[model samples]
Target: MTPPRNVHARAALLMLGSTLGFGLMAIFIRLASKDIPTWEVAFFRNAFGFLSLLPMLALPALRQPRPAAAFAASVRTDQLPRYVIRTAIGIASMFCGFWAIAHLPLAQAISLAYSSPIFVTIAAILMLGERVRARRWTAVALGFVGVLVIVRPWSHAFSLGSLVAVAAAVLSALVAIQIKQLSQTDKADTIVFWTYALWVPMSLLPSLFVWRWPAGIEWLWLAATGLMGTVGQLLWTRALKLGDVSALTPISFMQLPVVTLAGWLLFGESVDGATLLGAGIILGSTFYIAHREAKLAREQRSKAPSEAVEPGS
Candidate 1:
């Protein structure tokens, strides 16, 4: 089904803006890597991002006023443990992704990370019990083939950096799954806030092993990393609010090209044809999966009973 015309337009614009910010974020991560350790880089990024969201949280509109009975009934305090687990998983994903960015060619790293949606589709089938049609399965198979093209396992031995990039994508898929689970009971802001709250400690742990003070110019890079992340998150929040996620998801594929161009022009790295080809395949598969899922969800909603059933019955 087509989304509303306004929603479609908003999704296109918002996702485009968010993706450009994400691409710039990749460039900042590379620049910061020159003098700062990846862990510290992750730490500052999370720290400044956390700091930046404070004002938004203070806004009256974002804070819902609750009656004592309604608050107790709607809020599930028992879900705290689940929130912590999701936060830990997210932090680990962040660490691995940052490490990959520091070590691999930026375009290659971004392309590999783009494989997360393929993993996400698989995870949805296995863990969420979501049904997948044959075409999506074929797309998933083709997507992995594309990954192998980028990795070229048969050519030479695997490069650890490239492998790390693949690992980042896989871990990010897991993180996305965890977030999906958490979203059943938690608001998006709550989940995102807890992620950084948990990140500071987990990210700081790695710094103990390889901490390095930033040089004068390095400070600028680190600050940009943090600031860009906060800006990206804000754009994402607004984007998702303005448009349905399924509509916006496909537009995010633009990040690969944007990041690739930034890598070449700013860092003098080449954007190879093979990486672009693989990214195209992966992104195509992901978009198909998202489109299918949206169709399934709409069908399910249309089938719901006129009167809602009790939670257990």
Candidate 2:
């Protein structure tokens, strides 16, 4: 469904804010992961985030569970099976992504995951039956090439962490496709809430095998990480709801620059020439994809009949 113009403007701003918050959260996660185990960090992040939302969820408007099968409804209820599937995929993606950030350079982790959009485009075509036009296909191809540049697999031995980040991107793409499918049958809040609600237990399983208590300061950082993540997710969902995905997506690329700067200032990491070049390519391709999507949306709207009547026909 087409959103109003005001929604588009708000979504764009919110998406930009979400990316910035996300980039900062990555930095904090990396810092906290230094002294704490990855699983512990992940657990705390989700647990604290869930606790933080208690007040919001308590509100009468958001209290009831969202039901599936009514795409536009403000409230909804169970589609337990779909939530289970999406939450599982999302948990894996988050687990691997957090682990990757803890182990790899922050910029590298962020850059690698940026490939998710390319994966999303492919999934949309293959699984969702979205048409693959020539320009979009070209953009998809270019985006992957940019990822290859960043990975540079042929030049050096690939790290397991790098592979994990790539896997995270693939899983994230699948989850996103699931969201798209669910959007056809469910309200946005229902899908978002269910994914998080179910993920808590699933994420706890692996952490249980290796869980350890964090120190006082570590707990604070972990709590902060969760807060940032929760806020970021809220901003992200709100953004997409306000505008076309294509219009809001390009703003997400801002995350790379934000993370890169954070890594430099906070961690003393340098941005190599290769990384910069690869980032440029990825950004360019993503911009093209966003432009194409917005163009397509506009074209569709233009072809629809106007509500206005002709003068005294």
lDDT of 2: 0.79
Error of 2 at 74 (Å): 6.9
Each prediction's TM-score versus the true structure: 0.88, 0.86
Which candidate leads the pack in TM-score?
Answer: 1
Alpha-carbon runs more than 4 Å astray in model 2:
1-9, 60-76, 244-247, 301-313
User: Each candidate's lDDT (Cα)?
Assistant: 0.76, 0.79
lDDT of 1 by residue, 188-262 (tens): 766666776677787788787898888888888877887778777778888877776677887787888787778
Local error of candidate 2 at residue 15 (angstroms): 2.4
lDDT of 2 by residue, 1-313 (tens): 6567777788888998899879878987998898787877888788888877644544545444642323325445557788898888888899899998988888888988888877888887788677867778888889888877777788763566688988999999999899888888777667766766777788788888887778878877898898888889889978866777776777898898888888888888887666677777877887787677667666666765764322110
- By lDDT, the best candidate is 2
